[model samples]
Target: MSDGWILGLDLGTSGLRGVITDETGEIHAEAAAPLTDQSPTTWSAALSGVLLELKPHLSRVHHIIADATSSTVMLWDNGVSSPVLMYDDGRATQEYAAIRDQLPADSAAHGATSTLSKVLWLRNHCPVSSGTRIAHQVDWLNAQFLGFPPPTDWNNALKLGYDPIREQWPDVIEQLLSPLSPPKVVPSGTPLGSVQEAVQDTWGFPHQCTVHAGTTDSIAGFLAAGAQALGDAVSSLGTTLALKIVSERPIFSPSHGIYSHRLGRRWLAGGASNVGGGSLLEMFSLEQVRALSKRQPGPKRGIACYPLRGVGERFPEADAKKAGLWPDKHLPEAVRFQAIVEALVAIEKKGYERLHALGAPAPQRIFCVGGGCRNAMWQRLRSAQLPHVVAQTVERPPAWGVTRLLADEGP
Candidate 1:
């Protein structure tokens, strides 16, 4: 295990990406394939394509770990099920309504996008077979190598009603999953089973290579930032702005889109704001954004803009009918864009304050990832707003995070 390489794969909505790395975090090779669709067939073929692309180093690989979109679910008997339920698929409203009232406000299972809701919907539409089992996106792929349905990781099982705090499924889940069996759940890095002989022959992996459980894509991304102790924080400035801080205690505010995900021995508590890069893109082109950000250090526009691309706010505040505010249109585009950036930093600041108010400690240091991280002005603005919080940069490839699980879990 010490001498061989570790392969970490990420089953993303758009593509499958992987990196081959050693225990010390030195990357040897990387491979990726576009996912035509989020189907088992597509994932199987894409995984093979990636492995074949990295065939030259396959013999040196010892451990395999993978992360996928949380809440994306499927079924398995002897074979995998069809019409995969995607993470964003909200067709389970009826099922969600039936059980949502029964779940606590803090419960991850209280949404239409939850895995429990999707599985309940699937069970209702399709007859459940005797040996059928529930599987997450990564769980189904792990089965290809293990030769049977494998246990899912805690991160992927959260919305499936497997409580991380108790480390077991509650009695309430039985009401929703009457006929189907939940996967035996484990922590993020627990080794499940060895790669089957046939898979080793086909993919050129070692005979005894192990496949370990992985987390949700978001958690994997968080792990990549290297926040180890309590109060360490990481922010993702993607299509949506996500804020997370490692805390000694769990925080739950589902109404504001805030909650906690167990991160090893601690809890990661934060929230997601609907206002993010998407809102910026609505008024300016990519080039315009970059140009405006570069000129930010020289800006004198004192105007403030509250730009919300969507109908409501989720994090920092909970309002379904919230409206966005914009500065006067007569102002120069440069001034306007700078105002938007300042607004975002305000929103991000408000978010952290909200977390602190809800029980999370003040952030010790903050690391940022995603498309917005490239904005030098935004980083500067964040520093100015949260003057006490140390700002650091880190590589944010989620596949790299999945690899850490194997590296940290010693033989």
Candidate 2:
């Protein structure tokens, strides 16, 4: 055992979370700071505040890894690695068209959610800052520790059009992203550099600490759940349902809205859908949703509702119309709600089954996470849908997985 601990930082959409994890994947101390706003200055200050909170435990910590929202993007100044643009700062909407036009017809085009697409937008709109080193959320946060540019993890880079299978950035992309050298890419667990001496001194961290390249939050959650088997999978049920299955190769699903993310040696193929418990919240308050769910009107009356809380969906674009509940013989409101829940669960099941049909093997067990995990009704319904498959809940925040990668700690 290495006589050191690993620090896991999760740059969450809402806040910056820091955890000091030992080799056994146990969190020693955890701290959190809500982001005042999704701005570079805000994030940097929040991160520094978190470091201060964790400073007391710095002596034993020797490694640092981070997991962040994949959608987060920023313009990194090459000189000081300063962020000129924030990830959630969507001022670059106009620049999306420039890159979308350039993308090959068959190849995927990252939407406004991608770091690359956002950078392309920023470059055009803010022409003076065109030469900045743009990086994803985790990479940018990691960079602050070393006071230098940080490398992006493979899983995090996959959406940015980095070809993980080839283990290199594509030539076509390089030629297209001319003038800007490909951002340094590294494996998720690779030790890039050590915490800078200045940071160490200020934060009271060990001088020997080495920071490892981590992954996106979803990838980290998958790791924490020990989704290692060929068919093991994880489902994160939040505002949107994000599901991933471990596979040997990428499963393309531009039609069904599935995208693949490389997690270590395996590929995590899945999709996100607009249908989640959030729909219930949108319609009713959280307490109301819980109260309504407790009503428990037995099995649904077959009223299918593609509950979409958003304007459009990346998957099953046809559902953009916000189709209402299918009327069937005076089904009770409680029954209709149950039916909607079943339909949403069925959508995720369909996504998994589609991936299997597309050549990826079906998962034997599904590890559940996020808010949905607490709902016994949903769990029972999901289990009933796939009677043979196991559904287990492991209440781990995504930060735990980042700690594993940074610490090289096995489950």
Candidate 3:
């Protein structure tokens, strides 16, 4: 195995994390810095701080890659003045409607929060000069090391309407985004160029060290799970329960919030549901949930519940007007908590079932990640609900996945 180390950085919603891993994927060192805000200044500061923390090991590093939250966008002329429009920003409703009218029904850009919609919105509301460049969060972050104009990966450009399969911007999108230039697109893990001279001089990186194209944070997390077979899957139990499975055929059902990201010869198909740790947080403190989860109750039929943080539902059954359901307030707290856990597992099973019906292979095994994975009781409950499928937790964060990409590309 090569002795050189690889650096992976993940720019998440809450913070920036960097991991230094050897050729075999064993982490040598890791560091993180929390972001106080979403502005380019804060992001750049956090990134620099994290890299400084990893500075001691820079000389051994051969490659660097980064993943950022998908759909977060910024406009740049000489430098950034405005805060990035985060992935969840909903100010592009009119742009979304216009995109829906222009693109196919199954296009990922049909949603209001998509990068395409945000680009259209920025064009009219946050106008930039003709010489300006538009870039996704990952693109901008990677450019900090590799220099501009920024280069983007296919996975990060999906919501921006770059057709990965065709490896080109579609005529419809080109017409809609007239005058503004799209960043050069390449596959995730493709090398952009060597780290800039200024970065190398400051960080002590080797002259040969290079920066590779990166994916979205979600896709990087999926890669970290180490799932390679057709039926392998990864389930994220964060604010929402998100699922993605490896498949030979891509699936797209915008109505159900299901989409696919290309993974080499295969596809990663899945969707997110409005049910997860957010439901448990509603009634119990972190300490209370930890204590309550340990006191397993005897087998009892769970109360019917749809544990959403608020109104509306996506995946399994997509209904914008769907209301969140809950057990009677009079029920014991332990009972209510267990019932909610079971209900979320049921929703997970329904999500997998939906995927199966839509042509994706049934999940042969699942690797779990996110904050909820810490709850052993929830893991047990999930395993019991999907008895035939093997379930386990992957402790590595998304930064490690980008390290894997670097290792795959070699020194």
Candidate 4:
């Protein structure tokens, strides 16, 4: 039987999942729905499907917790909000060019995928009303449950230019969108409001159920990883390889492809490298890559290959125009394989170095999370490349950490 159950929904970039867990982190029931970079109607429909699957056990669930993929922006207007753009939508190149012109010469352009660029793109393309307010994905989701406009949580607001350290949206946001509505800002874990009475009734949840302000999935995953203090970093390897290091102070590195985020009690500073395993897979079929790994000792090869397939360059290199797959000349499969592995390891190492150089505490140990942790060869390569540091993988995914958080009580 379920006891002190909580519902944690992960609104991931690939899909949506709901896990019902007890106070001790035991998952009792779960449901998931497939999704993609679709419109608001699509996301709503998918979420509804997943919730309906959890209907039979609804009575056991106490709190509803959720966090969507970060930086996805939506338009809030006429009570019928719609998803205008996704974080990866590159249609905003022109908008990005415009923003760079406004930014300080020292302030490198915000990544093309940032929420600010998305907002600018929509404003330029769609005829949104001047009264419209734009919000991150999860913020809009919270608004749906509250039956009113909802504010963005601090962490998710970072990419939108909300000053988390100061707890205020930047004035530039107003200046950029002259008649645009300003979004209210809230702290992570703060309850936006109680779930709408009608939704409560339909879902068989308590009428007094609170709707906690959700964050990005990555932020929730990091929190769930049991990273007790600062100087800890979490790396996720999926469609993209991303590293996030928690810092006591804000660390901005537009040059390093770095973006700053506020998570739990500290700020998350790191960058996403364009060259992840996925991009490598494109050049070498999965079967071929696995076969090659059997003959290669990875870091032992000493070949240099700076990953970067399509997305420009970030960190260490810091050149947005830097071309990917460097060195016009070529090398053998074994060397290329080693270079590829080292390239990613280099990103990990350089990231740590950059963070330390910025005055952040050094990480004594890095807790590895995500699919990359499962790759035995990748682990060996990382160990060889980072001999000074220890990397350990958790059997379960960091996403499961979200379930653990919902089931526990904390301040």
Candidate 5:
């Protein structure tokens, strides 16, 4: 195995993050650049800037892997289409319904903004030429390094209707969208090819550096958090709450917004809840939240705040028309803030319960990530609700996770 450094790049919704690390996991260099927009040209420029920032370390890098926000897709001919559909874009309602009617009820493609739905919408509304291709953000970004028509990993392909268990595109999907061709799917860390000569010449990357297949950003985060055991889990307390538990068997419950991503012999199963730090931010500023964190959480106030950003809920309950529930308007600011924190913890507890009930191994320990994980009071609140599962904070950037892929280390 090559002992040179591995380059892991994460193309997130807002920016690009790159890290250069050795096989022993020592960080050599790291850099990040903000993305002003989601357009293909913008992505290209931002990525080029980030790579240039890492140009000093390129000579030592042997392999490269990447991860991107789930379901962020674009149409590719000689180049990417204008105005690529973002992961959360919900303009494919009709296509979503058509997909739901054909796939199993438990399939993750039920969501209106799923990659598969986007593809269908593109076929009808966008109307690409026969030679045009469908590619996710990770695929397109990585293609700049390896080549165009990039091969995608299973995790990124899940919402696109690729059956990871069968390791092939289902006939139903092929027949349903016969006009479009899907990219080749491969295991997350499988080598695709070498870095293109142009990239090597421009960035000073090693001529022999290989480009490996990549996964979605969430999975990349899970891997970076170092949850390798079957029952290990990671909870991301970002703008929204997301959970991923490592399991020996896959779990699929679309009704509850639960699904699994293949992780070699094991699986990563969990869901995202609409309730999280975003809810707290809506009612209080970051300073206020930090101030409230200093206040000890009193006994269960029975606030029952079903914190949703808008008129919908995904995990623990999949009610599209569900409204945000909050404590009585008369409650004090401190009290209400504590209640919201507790309510999010309640949602996390229920999410784990649902996963356990679905045959996933009970999470022995849960690693916390994202901005909300910094709140000591909230961590204590979560531990109180999930006493059986240990809660601890972990700093695992998605770029680090993809670096592990290049190292061929199991998550």
Candidate 6:
């Protein structure tokens, strides 16, 4: 491969981000656009807005790849799109319940929010014919540029019942979804040939520019953090704290909400904690949280706090009725804040312990990302608890990692 620019697009729930990078993985330009809803067209506009920002570099961009939130999918008939299903869309409760007993606890398809459930929900309520197929978020976006939806990556196919171990779609899922099938599966970084001439003309890119497969948003973030070796991990401290580690083998435990994503030859496995920055903010405003985090946090406070935000807890333990347990209101506000922050740290600690108990290696080194990772005091708190949490980090936009996919000289 010769020297040329590459584009990595990330279609996140809150927004869409794109980065232009050289073949060396050095980022040159980055752009983003806001997203208001789950509409597929919104994703397209966001992509165009980002590309327009880098229009000057579009011609030199020879390869393009993208990542989208895992499980966000829509149905396609022949070649047209249906209403998109957001990742958190959980209207598949009945369907999930029907099959939940049949699946082993280790199955990724055991949740209502899973692609497997969402597709079943659509099938039961919506109509489907011979040409009908489920398309993940990235798949739909790729279809726009490729003239038809190309194959999906293995990482995105995980929640859709593609067995990475078997390297094929399992018969159980195939039989269940009989008519409602998943898109063709491919490993991340597989080139899908040239861009549609119309898209090429509209985007001002060369007709020969290729579109390559990309993975899930979280998986892209893992790659962006540059943690590839065994035991390397990432803790995304965003709305929720998510843990993922590189392991030689896969790990899955429906009990603890743990599931592994197939990445090349290794596996990225861990669960997410319901309590994190969002929970922290519920106790105080963003500004107040920032200001409070700068304080000493005062010896983990005598008063304990669970600080859960919603009705259920998945990681560290699974309880459908779990609710936030807060310190008394009469207590000093700052003290309560410290207790909550400490509680969040505790959840992070136990999440990793859960992964370890399930056979994943203890994190040799952890690279943190997300908005909360910027909190200096929070890092201090985490480092004090988990020494392996790296202070200095190289967290790139998720887009940057997907760019590496097409930037590579692989097939």
On TM-score, the leading prediction is: 5
Where's the lowest-lDDT run of ten residues in candidate 5? 387-396
| Candidates' C-alpha lDDT | 0.83, 0.72, 0.83, 0.69, 0.85, 0.83
Which is the winner by lDDT between candidate 1 and candidate 3? 3
Clashing pairs in 5: none
* Candidate 2: clashing residue pairs, number: 0
Q: What is the TM-score of each candidate against the true structure?
A: 0.93, 0.90, 0.95, 0.89, 0.97, 0.95
- After TM-score superposition, the amount by which residue 348's alpha carbon in candidate 2 deviates from its true location, in angstroms, is 1.2
Clashes of each: 0, 0, 0, 1, 0, 0
> After superposition, which runs of candidate 2 have C-alpha atoms over 4 Å from their true positions?
1-3, 78-98, 101-108, 129-131, 316-332, 387-392, 406-411
Model 2 over residues 325-410: C-alpha lDDT tens digits?
43353766567567767877887787778778887888778887778777667777888786344565557667777776644434
RMSD of each: 2.3, 3.0, 2.1, 3.1, 1.5, 1.9
Query: Using alpha carbons, what is the TM-score of model 5?
Result: 0.97
TM-score of 4: 0.89
Residue 58 CA displacement from its true place in model 1, Å:
1.5
Taking the tens digit of each residue's C-alpha lDDT, what string does model 5 give over 171-245?
788877768887789898888899899889999998889888888899889878877787998889899999999
Cα lDDT of model 1 overall? 0.83
For candidate 1, list the clashing residue pairs, or say none. none
